[model samples]
Structure formats: C-alpha cells, structure tokens
Target: MNLTSAAMIGRINPEALGASTLGLALYNTCLMFGIGLTAAISPLVARERGSGAVATTDAIRRLVHAGFWNNIIVVIPVWCLLWEAAPVLRLLGQESRLADEAASYLHVMQWSLLPALIYLVLRSLLAALERPRWAVVTGVGAVVLNFVLNWLLIDGHAGLPALGLLGSGLATFLSNLFMAGALSVAVAVDPRFRKLRLFQGLGRVPWRACATLWRLGAPIGIGIVLEVGMFTAATALVGHYDPVSLPAHAIALQVASFTFMVPLGIAQAATVRVAGAAKRAASARAGWVALMLGLGVALASAVVLVTVPEPIIGLFIDPSEPGAQAVTRAAALLLGIAGIFQLADAAQVVLGGMLRGLQDTRMPMLIAMFSYWGVGLPLAFVLVINNATTGVWIGLTAGLFTVALLLLGRWWVFSSGGRRPPIA
Candidate 1:
C-alpha cells in the first residue's frame, strides 16, 4: 500500500517517487535484522503452546516479553542505520541527489522503527496464537490509514502544506505508530490475550530465552538480508542507468510485491499451521500442501501479469502521463519477467515459512546466501552490465528458482527422516 502510494506520487513527481522507494528500501533492509529476530516469536509461541510444558499463557507471556525486549535491544543499531541512510546509500554508489532525498525521508521515517517492531511482535504473537484475524483487522486498518494520510499529507490537502516524498515517509511513520498502539491495545484489552499478562512482568529480561530467540532468529534475519539485499542491489544497479530506470524498476518491483502479498499471507498461515502441526503427520506433506496453495495463487497472478502487463503497470502510473511511456515499457518488461518466475517466488516464500516453522533457519540461511548472493548477485552484476534492467530481473528470477529448488530438496530430506523436532 505504501509503495502504491509512492507509485502514485511518481505520477506527480518522479524524483519524490524515486526517493520514497529508495528510502523505503533502505528502511526495510535496515529493519530486516529486527524483523527476523522477532519472527522467532510466532514459531516459538506455537511450539510452546503445542507442548503444554508450562502453562500456555505463562510460556507465551515469557516469549512475548523476550521478543519485545529483543526489539528494544536491536532498535538502537537499526535507528543508527536509518539515521545514516543517505551516507550508507552514498557509500554503496547511489546517486548523491537521490541519496540525499532518501535521507531526508528517512530522517522522519526512523521514528517509527520502535513502534513498527513492536507491531511485528504483536502480529507474530497473534498469528501464533491463532488469533490472526485480529492482526488482519489491524493490517487492513493500517493500510487504510496509510492511504488516507498519504492523500492528505503528500499532496497537502485541506489547507496543509505539500510535503511530497517526505510526506509519504511521515505517513508511513504515523501509520505504523498507529498500528503498534492499536494492536497493543487490542491485545491488552482482549480477553484471550489478557490472560497472558504481556505487560505484567515487563521488567524481567529473560536473557536466556532472548538468546535462544537470537540464536534461531538472527539467521532468519541474515537470510532476509541476503534475499532482500539482492533486490535492493538490483534497484541500486538500475538507479545507475538513468532517471527513468529507478522509478521504472521501483514500479515493477512494487507491483510484484503487491502480488506477493497473497503468497506472503499464505506463507504466514503456513508457518503457524506447520509449527502447530509440529510432530504430527508428515510435516513434509503439510508443508507441500501449504506450498501448493501459495503456488496456485501465484500462478493466477502470473497469468494476469503475463496476459495484461500494461494494465497492471498502468495502475501505478497512467500511460497517458508525459514521460510515463519509458517507465511503463520498462515496468512491463520486468513484470513479464516477474510473471515467469512468479511460481518460484511463491514456492520459496512458502517454503521459507514452513522451514521457519520447523525451526530450520541455518540451512535455509546457507541456501539463501548461496542462491541469492552466490548465484543471484553475480548473475545480476554480469547481466546488468550487459543487458541493463532486463538482465537484472532475469538474474533475480534465476536466484528465486535456485533457492526454491534447494529449499524444496532440503524439506524433502528432513521431512523424510522422522517426526523429530526441527533442528535449531
């Protein structure tokens, strides 16, 4: 939704759109570690709820507490990165002007980091507890809020000053802030979650539990960095080509990301379901079911992109807009490539979620590094130099395919062996 809003901004002002995308890319990547770290909450909470070792509520409370504290622990460094976003992008060879624009946006967006991470924990907890509807409700609300705020702030409606791209960042920050507070309150007041007493013993650190979370989750975070970084790197490569290339790449990527939300939601469901299924019937079979369901939706999305790429691209920017032809053309090309690899992307994401449910992060991390950096990045570099934007996305498709295959193979092996708990 945020990206779509930014894409709309691109229609009015391309530079702001480019800056917003770059700024958001930097923001998301910087928060990757924290997001990954907190992801342990869902699987861990699910496993504990399944085990009945201690009281379910007690176990969940501790896990939630530990996850919350871990966020606090990680927020400082994440904040530092957000604060220094422009310098980091500049260091990575991003255009100085674009970097400065991204930095200006990040300056305001950084304020949301703590709240956003908290929101993540809340969502993870809700999903793990099978109270995902609450999270969904909150998410829908946030998207709505984001859209309204973007309209009001970005374009300076109702007697407000037009803040442009910076307005987009501020909208993101405020919407996230609203989400965190709303979800937290919802959990606090709800009878189901109230028993967990999440805030009751907030002072207790649970250092060992947190360390375990870090142990399991940091790899997930690293894996995220590896995967997401490859795309960000691709964006950087595109940014070097020409002004049109960056927004074009951003538009195509955003469209692909928008489609990805379907699989992403399914993947999240898969994680919760698989984790809950733990030692039950073939974990592999359960994983396959999840993978197939996600793939089905992805295939449908692929058909849409393949058959009518122009309309999808048009959603971001009007074909009739001046200077939009080049962007539309470029985005159309990327979307077609995105269509070809859509299933692979869906498969990998669902598989990753299933693996996370299995608490099998290390191997996946290794595979992602090997697939994305080892195969994907090198290919992208060579291809971008030779083929420009087209080459980069082709490389992306290759990386996604490779990762999906390796992940499927690993799940096949592990699920074949035993009902044993997943390795940490």
Candidate 2:
C-alpha cells in the first residue's frame, strides 16, 4: 500500500514522492526496533509449541503477554523519533523543504505506529499458533481499504478534503487501526485460540519473562535497525544528488521491497518450522531447504525485473511525461542492480531466519553491523562521489553479499555440531 501511494505521489510530483519515500524509510527504520521485539514472539512460541507439553501452553501465554508489553514500551521511543523527524532529517542534510514535507507525513503517520505494532504482535501470535488464515484475511482487507482511502483523501473525492501526502499517512493510520481491531476480534471470538487461552491473563506483567524477551529481542531489534538504517542512510545520500535521484531510488526500492516480501514470508515460516523442530532434527538441511525456496523465488523475480525493467519502472511514473525519462532510466538501472543482488538478499535473510530458529541473534546483529555500517556505508560514501545514487545500491549489494557468506559459514559450523549458544 505504501508503494502504491508512493507511485501515485510520484506521478503527481516527484518531490512529493521523494519526501514520502524518505519519510517511510525513516519510519521503517524506527518501526523495526519495535517490530524486532515482536518478531521474537513467533520463535519463542514455536519452541514452546514444539515441546508438545500442555504445560507449554502457560509459556505461550506468558510470551504473548510479554510481546504486547514489549511492543507498547518500545513504541514510546519510536514515537519520539517520529516527532523529531524534521530535525533529524535536517541533521542528516536533507533539503529543508523536503525535510519539512517528510516531517509532516511522519507527524500523521506516527499515530499508526502503536496500532501497527499491536497488529504485528497479534500476527506473530497467529503465526506461532499456526493459524495464519486470519492474518491473511485481515491483511488483504486492510490493503483494499487503504487503496480506497488514499484515493479519496489524497485527491479529495466526493467532497472530501485533499490532504496530499498527509492523506496517505492518514490512510495508513486508519488501515492499521482497522487491522488491529479486526484481528483482536478474530482472536477473541475464535474457539481455537480460546482453547489455548492465549489471552487468559492480562494483568500480570511477568517482569522476568519480559526481561528474557528483551534479552532475546534486543539483538533482533538492533540488527534490524542497523540493517535498515543503512538503507535510510543511502536514501539520505541519494537525496543530495539531482532531484531525480531520490525518486528513482525510491521507485527501485519499492520494487525491491515487493520482491523482498516473498522471501520474508518464507523466512518467517522457516523460523517457525525450524524453531519447532527438535534439536536432533534441526540441522543444515532445514536451513538449506528454506534458502533454496527463497532463492528460487528471488531468481524468478530477478528475471521479471531484468527482462521488463521499463514496464516495471513505468508503473511508478509516466514515460511520456516531460522530464520523467531521466527518473525512469535511473530507476530501471537501480532495478537491474536489485536483480543482481536478489540471490544474495534471499540467502542472507533466510539464513538469519534459520539462525533465529536456533535462538541466535547477537552474533548475527554484530555481523550485520560489520557488513552495513563498517563496510557498506563507507563504500557508498566513496562511490557516490562519482556514481551518485547507483553507488548506494552497489554498496548495499556488497553488504548483503558479505553478510550472506558470513551467515552461511556460521550456520555451517552450528549444523556441524561446533560450539554454539544454547537455544533461547
């Protein structure tokens, strides 16, 4: 839905698209911290569920409780970050007008963060319980509703106020609110969930369990922040180039993000299934299966991106529009870069998910930091001097490739019975 909105905004004005893109990049960077906490829930629940102990039901309930509180607590700081978006963007050297516009979008979008986190926690709950149909239903419904809301509010249809980018932000907030409410109702009314008593106790905070969740989740959160922060930094760097650079970067990123969603789903499933597997059965085999699945999807997507870059890029901007050729060309080139890195991207994410299944996060977080900031950012800074926006994409590709290799090596050792941390 965000990509769709960005496309629409890009057609209306490239600057709006750029501003919205920067806003969303920043939003996701901050949002991932809270999401990281919730991301732990699925594996934790899967491990408990794998025990096949009726007693583990109690552990599941406690984990769900912890997830809720963790999301709530983390969102507070995220909100503060959103509130200060303008100042932060300024410090990052974004154009003043673009920074102000992005900040306006963030101000409205921030209201959705808490609700979105709540929805994510519930989605994690459902994933752990192996009941994903409800999540699918709610997600589809939210996306459809967002489409209508953005159309009506962004351009002022049927006496509605035309809120431009802010309308898109409002649509996000409303759709998220709807998802949280609908999912809550679905969980509350479903007999399957009721049988497990997932929400039985709400009053107790269970500080110990929460602390354990934080201990396990902090690295996941930090890893996500570091990884996405690299892209955010790339967006900032790209913004300093010609006007077309930011919009083109945003368009290519949207396409890459869509491709990523496929592997991300596989990765999530890999985490749950692998985590649920008994220690005796948890080996490189499971990770390899997941990696192959993700790589297959990535390969297919890369073919589409490479063969039809113009049509794909055409989706976000009119080729016939004056001055749009440059943006389209730039985006197409970035998509080609995205295509080259798809395999590396798929391998790294799936491996990370497999490691999460093994209750490992801290080391992966360090690996990400080393690959992204220590390696990617510096490379991008140097290359951007001559390559502009393309430099950032190349740097990111290198980082992902590095992480993929390192993570594969780590998993190889773990599967070989080398020294490894105990599963959380």
Which candidate gets the maximum TM-score versus the true structure?
Answer: 2
lDDT of 2 by residue, 84-154 (tens): 99989999889899999999999998888888888888898888778899999998899898988888888
What TM-score does candidate 2 reach?
0.96
* Per-residue accuracy of model 1 over 1-424 as CA lDDT, tens digit each: 5665765577665666777778778777767778898888888877766665664676677778888999898888778878888888888778899899889988998888888899988898888878877778888888899888888888899998888877877888888988999999999999987887888888999888888889999999899888888888888887875556777788878878888888877877787777777465655677889999999999999998888988776766756667788888888888888998889999999999988988889989999999999898899899887789999999999999999999988777767774444587
lDDT of each: 0.83, 0.86
TM-score quality measure for candidate 1: 0.95
RMSD of each: 1.8, 1.6
How far residue 399's Cα lies from its native spot in candidate 2, in Å, is 0.5
Best model per lDDT? 2
List the candidate 2 regions with Cα displacement exceeding 4 Å: 421-424
Evaluate model 1: give its lDDT.
Answer: 0.83
